[model samples]
Target: MAATELKAQARTGVGKGAARALRREGLIPAVIYGDKKPPLPVSISYNEALKRIYAGGFLSHVITLDVDGEKHKVIPRDYQLDPVKDKPLHVDFLRVGAGARINVQVAVHFVGEDKSPGIKRGGVLNIVHHTLELSCPADAIPEQVTVDLAGLDIGDPIHLDAVQLPTGVQLHGHEIDPTVATIVAPSGMRAEEAEAGAAESAAPAGETKE
Candidate 1:
C-alpha cells in the first residue's frame, strides 16, 4: 500500500452544527484511532478527500496524514457520503502496521470466454456473483482478483474454490454459496427453434416448408 499525502488540521469543535460549519468552509471532519493511540479529531479539505477515495481503494491505501507538524501513517477505515449532495460527511482513519492481517472485500474480474460446453453450443452466459471477501496481510492485499472464464462452457458454473488468489490470501466464500455463472440457452431462441422443428415435422413428407 502507498501513502497519499494530504494536509490535516486539528479540530477543536464537536457536534453536528460544528461539523456542518466545517464542511461549509470546504473542510471534512475526521478522526484517527488505533489500538495504541487515543482517538484524535482532525479535518481535511473536501477536494483532497474526494481525490483519494474516488478511485475506490482508498480504504486500503495507506496515507501519511500530515496533521499540523505530526505525521501519522493511517488508512481510511470508514467514511459517510452525503446522500443528495454526495459530499464527505465524517471520516475515520485507522493506524496500520506492515504485518497486520486484514479482512477486506476485493473486486472480482472475470476474464475470457464463457468456458462451459453449453456456451460453446450457443448458451448465454449468466454471472450471478461479483465481489468476494478475502483475508490477507495488509501489505500483500491486491487491488483486484481475476477469474479465468475462458475455459468455462455451458452448464459449467465456476465455483469459489476455482478462483485463484495471491499467496497468503484466503477467500471467505463457502463451498455452499450458489455463485452461479452459467452458459445458459436463451429461452426465446430455444423456444423459437423448438417451434420451427415442430412445424417442419408436421408438414407433408414430400412438401417443402419455408
Candidate 2:
C-alpha cells in the first residue's frame, strides 16, 4: 500500500514540437489529470520511465509524483509507446484522492505451482487470464492477484472465483464466472490417448475363435 516517490519536471509548453524537444532531451512528456482538477503537464526521464514500465505492474502501482516541488498522488491511466521501436512516447496519470476508487488491471501470480500434482505429472499449466481487471481503492490497489495451484490435478480448472484478492478489491465478472487457468495434458499424454482411442476403434467387430 506504500506509494513510490518519483521526481518529475513540470513542463511549460505543450505541443507536438515541445514533446519532441523533451524526447530529444531524454525526457518523456506526461500529464496528470482527473479527480475534477485541471490537467498538469510534466516530464519524466525516458530511461527511468522505461525501466519502471518494463518492471511489471507499472499501471497498478501508486506513485507520489513530485513535479518540480508540488506533489500529487496518482496512478497511471494510460500510456503511448512507439510502435516501431517500442519506446515510451507519453504517459497519462489519474489523480488519486484518499477515498477514490479506480479500476485497474492487476497481474496474476500463481503460488504453489511446484506442489501441484498436475504439474508434477508433466501436465501443462495453461493460463487463461494473465491479468485481471479490478476495481480497488486508489491507495490500496493490489500489485498482483495470487492464485493457489496446490493439489491441482491435470483436469482441474481454476475459476475466477477461486482467486483470492485483497480486502476491499472488487471483481465484476459476475454474469459468467470465467476460468483463470487450467492444467491440460501434455502433448505426449494427448498422443497416447489418441493412439489408445484409435486402437480401440480398430478392433475387429467379428469374433474369431482361437
Candidate 3:
C-alpha cells in the first residue's frame, strides 16, 4: 500500500493538563520514539489525523514529524480513544525506517462465502478467530488478511495454513494451532435424525398401532 502523507509538529508540554489543553485547542498530543533520537513530544491536528485514519490503513502511513522544522520518519504505534465520545485522545509515534520490521495486528477479511456442502445443506459456518498477528516491513504491511472458505466442508477445519499472507508477511500464530473457521450442523438436522429413527421403528409380531 502507498504511504499516506500527514503533517505533525513537536510539543513542548506533558501530563494530562497539557494534553487536555491541546485537545481543547483541537490538536492531538503525540510522541515520537526511535533508536538514535530521544523521544520527542509532538502534537498533530485532530481533524487531519482523523481524516487520514478514517480512510483505512492509517497505521501504515509514514508521517513527517516536523519538530521545529526538522522532519523525522515515524509510524503510529498506538492510539487511545474516548470510549463514549469515540474521539482520538492520544497517539504514540514510533520512529522507524523503510527497512525496519515491526509486529502489528492485521485485520482478518473474508474472501468467499462458506459454500461448504454442509452449510448448503443447512449447516452453519462459525468463525472463531478475527485479526492475526504478523511481522512485516512497515512499508509492505497490509490492511487485512483475506481468509477463503469456499471449499470447506462441514467437518473440514480451516487452519492457519489455509490463510494467504502478503509477500513478506509472517503469522505469529503459526507455531500454535490455527483454527480459522468451523462448520456446524444446523438445528433442523436433528429432525432428520428423528425421522430416520421412526422409519426404522417396527411393531411387535402381534401388536400393531391403529
TM-score to native of every candidate shown? 0.79, 0.91, 0.79
- lDDT of model number 3: 0.77
Tens digits of lDDT, candidate 2, 71-123? 99998888899999989999999899879888888888889989999999999
Candidate 3, 1-210: lDDT as tens digits: 565545777778999999999999999898888867788888898997787667766665566667777777777888888899878888888887758888877777875564557667766777777777788887787878887767766677778787778888887755565787787777778778778778778534566789
Order of candidates by lDDT, top first?
Answer: 2, 1, 3
The digit string of per-residue lDDT tens for model 1 on 1-210 reads 445687999999999998999989999899999858789999999988887778687776667889998998777889999999887888999877658777777777777764545656777878776666778787777778777777665567777767767899886655454463666677977899899999999998886788
**Which pairs of residues collide in model 2?**
none
Q: Which model scores highest in TM-score?
A: 2
Candidate 3: which pairs clash?
none
lDDT of 2: 0.90
Worst 10 residues of 2 by lDDT: 169-178
lDDT of 2 at 130: 92
Residue 7 displacement (Å), model 1: 2.7
If candidate 3 were superposed on the true structure by all CA atoms, what would the RMSD be? 4.5
TM-score rank order? 2, 3, 1
Candidate 1, position 65, lDDT: 89
